[model samples]
Target: MDAIKCHNLSFQQGEKCLLSRVNASFIAGKVNLILGQNGAGKSTLLKLLAKSQQPSSGVIDWREQDLQTLPLPELALQRAVVEQQQTMQFDFSVRQLVSLGLEIQLGSELVKAYQHVADFDVVLNRILQICDLGDLAERSVLNLSGGEFKRAHLARALAQIWPLQQTAQEQPDFSGKWLLLDEWNAALDMRHQQCFASLLKTWCAQGLGVIMVVHDLPLAQQLADRVLLLKDGQVFAEGDSQTVLQKTTLENGLQMQLQIVEQSDGKTMLLPKF
Candidate 1:
């Protein structure tokens, strides 16, 4: 079954329809990539899916349940989001910040808030390694670079997403965890893209659903199981990576020239050498 779904989705901002009648399905255990030009409603769609903004039409169905049927806290327990920007004006250590996902109370002048969980350390370490922030775990978050800080925030969300084994009534099965990672690779170099892709590959294997919005078509070609191409607020094409990442749509969508250079190694790549 599809992990997350949008039905007749549309969002309007007064005189403009940002997105229109869009229906999309994101599969579990696979990397589903969204490709679109600027102003094609990629970020708007993500905001709707994230529940940070309400859709002007249609609905979001997470798992088999309609998101409208669930409360905010329930939705929070089911998904984790990683946005394009990681803006923090406050100072905090990377370790402390990541641990905040464990429900640490905000410290006040009267009393310092503290909460402890034995599982937090394990999860934090695993996420730090996954995001390549293990060494930076002890560093102050305010001192990290854009990419480093973004990875730290990503790690925090990943840490929260990591499954825990509790003996009680069994916490909600994260087998339904919807990972909405948007523009995570925009600021990183090629190497970081590969690293991020690798982590998505591993997490999906463990039943995490990844809906990644990316502009790097070549990387999407290499990493995604399927592709959903958005053009001018509509779905221009969508299918297996090969079908959706075709030469024609890739060019038309961006109104730019491209050439599909086929390697002797039986690999095809799109280039702007036209």
Candidate 2:
């Protein structure tokens, strides 16, 4: 099923257009990766999809419902967004920051009820464990390393959609939810990146649709089930990984000389021209 559909979407700032005539469909249970050069409007496209910015023209639909028309609370229940940069002015603890999702999703009364029965603490603990933030739960968010902060925000995003209150008696599933991520792996080392990738795969398996903007070509190639190449504020190429990610497409879209190598294990690697 398609989680989101963008038709002839365009965005502009003053007289300069950032995205023009963009069309795409993000499918459920798949990782939709967007790639582009620095000023190619990848971030703009993500903001548009997340409804943080409105398009100058065209339409975006979530499950065939008009996206812009949905109430903010309604939209929040169905989708979560993790932006490329996050700035917090307050000295919030890491655990408090992650718990914000519960506040947003379940409100005080429901969150309290869930904690009473299912134990939201247990749920939060497992989330922190997966994001590798178990040890830093009480630390101030301002004191964390860059990688740690990113992982903390990722846990928060996941918490927004995770059915934390579901017990063994309830039917367990994650369906009709979407995660829009912008450069989520930008701060991570290889180990954390792989850990996040594995977590994303598990979520996708449970039917969460994810759309991410990433600069790491090889990592994108490895994790994306589908890819969209953006150039000059428009889609340059888009399709399955093997179709949209290729030597010629990357060279043209990124305006760089690149080499694609096939390893003995049949995995592809992308390297820049020397």
Residue range with the least summed lDDT across 10 consecutive positions in model 2 = 108-117
lDDT of model 1 at residue 36?
A: 90
| lDDT score for residue 82 of model 2 | 93
Q: Model 2: clashing residue pairs?
A: none
lDDT of 1 by residue, 141-184 (tens): 88998888877877777766666654424433447777888898
| Local distance difference test values of all predictions, in order | 0.78, 0.86
Candidate RMSDs in order: 4.1, 2.4
Predicted candidate 2 versus true structure: per-residue lDDT over 1-274, tens digit per residue: 5668899999989999999999988998899999999999999999999888999999998888998899778888888999899988789998989988755666546546445434677777777877888899999999988888888898898888877557735543678888999999999888999988988888788888999999987788789999989999999998998888888888999999998787899876887777
Q: Judge candidate 2 against the unseen true structure and give its global Cα lDDT, from 0 to 1.
A: 0.86
User: Model 2, 257: alpha-carbon shift in Å?
Assistant: 0.8
Against the true structure, what is each candidate's TM-score?
0.89, 0.93
